[model samples]
Target chain A: MDEFSFIDSIKQKYYKQPTLLKGVGDDAAVFRQQNKDIVTSVDTMVENVHFAKYTMSPFHAGYRALAANISDLAAMGAVPAFYLVSIVIPADLSNEDAGSIFSGMESLASLYRMDLIGGDTVSGKELSISITVIGYTEPGRARYRSSARQGDLVFVTGSLGDSQAGFHILANKGEYEEESYFIERHRMPSPRVDFAAKLSGIKRVSLNDISDGLANEVNEIADASQVTIILNEKDLPVSPQYPQFPVDLQHKWKLYGGEDFELVGTVAEDDWESVKEAASNTDTVVTPIGYVAERSLSSKVYLITDNGKIPLYSEGYTHLK
Target chain B: MDEFSFIDSIKQKYYKQPTLLKGVGDDAAVFRQQNKDIVTSVDTMVENVHFAKYTMSPFHAGYRALAANISDLAAMGAVPAFYLVSIVIPADLSNEDAGSIFSGMESLASLYRMDLIGGDTVSGKELSISITVIGYTEPGRARYRSSARQGDLVFVTGSLGDSQAGFHILANKGEYEEESYFIERHRMPSPRVDFAAKLSGIKRVSLNDISDGLANEVNEIADASQVTIILNEKDLPVSPQYPQFPVDLQHKWKLYGGEDFELVGTVAEDDWESVKEAASNTDTVVTPIGYVAERSLSSKVYLITDNGKIPLYSEGYTHLK
Candidate 1:
């Protein structure tokens, strides 16, 4: 099988969108951008840097690429529309492995109902996959982390630190039976599209998807909006999957771990009840871990721990550069 | 400067489009796609394989990435609007080298008035760049290469053989003075977007950008349209810059060289005069090179050289895997 066959496999599995005038098999894709505001993000995942073939299947790695991109769109409350993928298939890649990757990407695309419009596949020494996800948001209603205001209540969707715990389990080659959830959390975390869509209806929502850990995302929102975030460490949400790890490691992963695909944001205190009403009837669990405070020139992020208060830094998941 | 600095530098040089609801510095860029069909394409360039830092600066390499994507849009007669770039920068790359690449991209961006909407920067062993260009075409009017009719006249914009010759000159490290034109053709080939826009007004137009050598592109159109294409060697437009190479090398490069960024297309015999008039005022030089013939199951492409008619195969620049 060659590159064209690889494309054929993708085409066979893609969900055709009404707006797609032309999909794969052209020099470029043709699509109609239904008169709406478009949300776009690009992310690249290198073989070893993002995932290892030994730790997870190629299927999981490919799935992670789209998951990460869709997370960005979800943060803005955009509906996934179309995506273009470019893959540098490594020379040593087995056909079975490559097929697994495409199949994995197909699974995510079908789940999200987004069309795989255009992509390029080329041979290279190291495998890298870059995806450009296109989605649409309601014009002025798209949420941004930079809009958080003082006295707003800080909140997050779903459990935190699950991805890091999953990494720990896999790194130690834990028993297969007990590790599936953790592994899925780390390798196949889905974007909070439904949850974000639910909350996006409210106007005071300021959101950022947590890819680089909760602390880092908090710092980003605080710095962007020129506010201080005070998080109660005891209030941090951790998955039931973390019982196997020691308390210290669990806290470490919970506070500084990344790739969780959870979302962190701020909403006005008066609108919290409305957001809770919107969040109801969804799979996601909402938690208020902190509150937005007036800007402090000394420190932007702080955690209220059992031992006392501590400043939080953006030290989560720095890639090997 | 670090990767963030690189981003800041790009932010400083980018143009904000009126359709862009939000530009860079967000999780995902937001834009309003006017009610038109969008043409999208992605390309990745790897270091050493696509360009050498010795012969060309990092700026030119970065510039070439966007130029290549714009060329694909030009072929479809789409107006270049927005683009996103993802770079896997190698660690050994100096800050200056990285700066040069961004500046190079900025120059092209300013020239085209296309917004640099979003991008990502990460560390990898080899420097690789991927660009996705988004443009718009009047619905149902975007030119596709799969519409050439039998008996249609084939035409190409600008000269060929120059990029390959420029490659040869650089490969051999010949003096820099006399080879500047050829080298520039190789390193900084501009997309013929304006030229394509002029001819796209004609209905008989079936266009393909000449990234893969002209012969290969001809084969694509013929195969897609179920027709045969025969090239007249005497009519082949070799750039005057090719006198440096011997006759045989010149012919080989002209017939099989790639990265030309020229437009190869066909027009009905009745529409040739109108097309010529449309092309005259443009800076591009349009030349008639061949004509489409009724499909034959046996052969798809043939070259009418002085020696004899020969079957043409795709022998364009093959990247090293």
Candidate 2:
């Protein structure tokens, strides 16, 4: 197809707005922001690394790519503004597959009012999609990974290990043919943008999403804030069938399995009750998992089990591994 | 490497900045724009299609990926602000190779004062790099492809066809070993950012980067503007060794070959002289190639030859093709 024709079709499908002064077919898209600071994040998903190549659907791949990046913004407590997408597909893939991916992404983007501004499309040896999401927040309202104080209580939105369970079901054969919850959780994740936005002035300390598992993310916050994180293993919000997996193995997996795109954050102990009430009103779950303490990087993450306190292992998905 | 550690190293190397209110290890990087509108563009380079699978050096791949996207901002006449990069590499490639790519991109980015913000990395079947660059421009200073008018004079900065020639020689056996002019052009063609910035207030008719060659870009301007584009074949610029190709295809290739990241723009003929002079003073060559005119739906591009005007053919790289 001619470049102009391709771009024109995309613009018609995606760039509909009074805010978009320019969109596809231009060298760059221009946007007017009411706020001064702009938040941006870029996330790339590959065929085998981020997802299993053969088992994944194109639509799910598209949704997951945007969802993962949008979750990052939620971690920052920033509102989604615009996004740029880059897709590299194998030459063997059908045009229908490519279109479905865009359709899925466009569906989410339109729902969020995230403008699909500009990006590159090319042929590659594997299917890969990278999205750069640009967002905004009140200049000082944005949260970071360095603000948690010694007495802050740590919290996480929604249940953990659902994504891991979802992945297990989706990656395996017959056991979950009718498991829509598992498939949907694996495919589409809510970024918790509204919840994060509500927590704006309530003092969110050391915020981030659970992409690299809950324990790994806690370790990240601990390392960044130079503080120790003490967790109550019994308090972990697990699903009803959590005991089906081996006891020790499941706990380890729950804390280390990546792709749990929930927001893990912290707040002052005093504000915890009010924050929980506000979150409940918004229909967003906020569970207190742990507390932040003085910096002790040597063994920062600890899990309180019935046996005794144990160091949380850092066995999360490593890129090289 | 663990995701956090990889991201931490990337942040230390590229995202060290005071203006960056927040950066990588966080959910998103927040930047203070000082009340400037953000101009954004994204470009991706895939292994086999964009660059030869094993021919282009990793450093060159990195350089080209960043340079190509940077050229888009230059086409829009916007100044560099910040960038986020997403890379997908094969599992077999060592971290050193990835480091080399980032180092090379960093070299170019430093010259432009582009803060490397945040990104995601994953292992793919082949190498791919996607960069999203955001620039700061005056509210309405951006030039677009739909604003060209009848009687508007077409202008291009720097010479064309050199990159095409460079690709031709580099693809042939034993030709890439020497330091040829075409090879240099292919490896590194400077984006005309300074010249583009100067043309911000001159009432630009239309603007676009000449990637996929000048013919494709001029057609884009014409189609977007709903006008005919007439080009003088003799007036086309040529490199010093013009007749070395197999046939007298210098002008033909310049009109149709891809990978020339020069800016092709249109402005009122009245201001063309002054614009040309100003561009020349900066050692930036600004040459007139054609004029805009009314066109029928079917035939919009006409090549002005000694024999008379004839229908122009589409010859650049088509993504769908």
Candidate 3:
């Protein structure tokens, strides 16, 4: 269980790249990406901070860290190229166990053509993983968060909060194999790269990955654009099992529970049909969740309910808090 | 003590850049580097791992995390451009203390021209800081560790083991105010950016930042290049305080103790004098430490001492052993 062996196992299990000039054994991972703008971002997952170690699988832990960072690149309409992972694992953990974590990360990186460039592995009291993803966007075509306007229609790429439901089911150890869909959603949420890449200029208003629940992320776009967000409760996409919950629970899960890796974005009114058509070709549905309004520079976000427009508190999983 | 407050404090204290498209608050920091070869590296500092939390000041902790990453860029002959810091702090710490950590990082970034880009802050059981630095090198001039040849003379910038001595003094609370030079060397080692920039076209044998002790790093370069390195112990540079150490302790600390952020490199034997002269103008002295030797392909590093040639073992710090 030495550092070199742990790193070797990771390299054998995960690092498969033709572009890497040098991989895990070197001081740095060297890569070359041509004809596109390189987009880079980093995300750190810590034990008892981002996740509880005993409650989550090491594979899922590894996958989630990479997925979260890839999602940031996806939000920018970039193709993930490579990643550097700095891991601080507990000293007691054997190299075999560490290899499991790295195996999971390497698998994801291989799947996405992400060359494992360089990372530092150190001993710590708990597990902490910091992954920095480097991606590329076509010249002058990267979508940004400042592009949303007053009249754009908001849309979400996939169903929300299934990951949260998965968390609850796994935590309770509820005996329901029928809940596999939600369980997998929570454990291994996909970063919407393919869906986002094709979503170039038309629906390329303000965009963010739905991580801190739709309610909070939607508000983030609204707050950033300095506009009012009107969320249509009926249009909010939910998993098939969502209705099985009581009304209050469903609302609570949909609004506050986090870890949904869907894409929440906005599109212009006239371009909505084409955006939907393009998304349809990818076998993914884009549901209209809301519309933008003139600046609602207030502390409140709201849901348009049948009863009336009611205040929707923007409270999701606050990692910092 | 809230997350927003913590972020606000960092924004006010550290994130000041006129060209920063988005700084601390956004999902990612955006900026444009001149279309030069973009050089990037990442380094992490962990509590009770990289530094003992009880012993290391939060400000030095913060400064060192950034400095280590910046040093990587310096080794690559790149200019400091931008950095993203991901900090995982224990919830028990206050917001103002968090501000001070960032304030320390800001002072270094401002001095080095590294803009504080976007970062993620989270509550964890222990403190951890990961910094990713992005810099630019003129096209095709970025130095690497694989470029050394058989006839190259190994060179080191500045004296080694000063940081280790500083560590000893600091640990014992030794009165070393008269030895301020060594203390500063340990507290803050300068990255040789200006000197490295001028060393272009000199065809360096290999280049690396010396943090994990000279012997260990020289072994790394030799291991990577499949060459034997021969070092003369008598020729090694020692700071003025070297005589204060008992002989064995001096050699042990100089050879194995880590955290000296200097450059260990190799150059053509013919270019040795010019390289030394160039380093002199930068107010840093470069000394020849060793020579690349032709050895059995399987031979490890060797050192020539008064006793005889002995295998050089890497007894430095390992992250997850």
Complex DockQ per candidate: 0.71, 0.75, 0.44
Docking class of 2: medium
lDDT, candidate 2, B146-193, per-residue tens? 888888888787777888777777777553333467886787767778
DockQ for candidate 2, please give it: 0.75
- Candidate numbers sorted by DockQ from highest down: 2, 1, 3
Worst 10 residues of 1 chain B by lDDT: B312-321
* Chain B TM-score (model 3 vs. true structure): 0.91
Off by over 4 Å in 3: A12-21, A53-55, A173-177, A201-204, A296-300, A316-321, B12-22, B31-35, B175-177, B318-321
State every prediction's TM-score relative to the real structure.
Answer: 0.94, 0.93, 0.93
Checking candidate 3 for backbone clashes, the offending pairs are: A122-B319, A123-B319, B147-B205, B148-B205
What's the best-to-worst order under lDDT? 1, 2, 3
Over the stretch B145-256, how does candidate 1's per-residue lDDT look in tens digits?
Answer: 7888888999998888888888788778655445888888888888988877777567758889888788888888887787889889899887665665888988877777
Which lDDT values do the candidates have, in the order given?
0.82, 0.77, 0.74
The local lDDT score (0 to 100) that residue A303 gets in candidate 1 is: 93
Q: What is the per-residue lDDT of model 3 for residues A1-321, given as tens digits with 9 covering 90 to 100? A: 676666665664455555444455544444444456666777888876777665567887888888888888888777787788888888676676677777778667777777777787777777889988877666555667667787898888888778877777777765654488987887787888887777665645567887787788877777777777788888888877777656886777777777777888888899888778768877777899888877666634579999999867677466422
lDDT of 2 by residue, A244-280 (tens): 6557757755788677788888888888887787688
Chain A, candidate 1, TM-score of 0.94
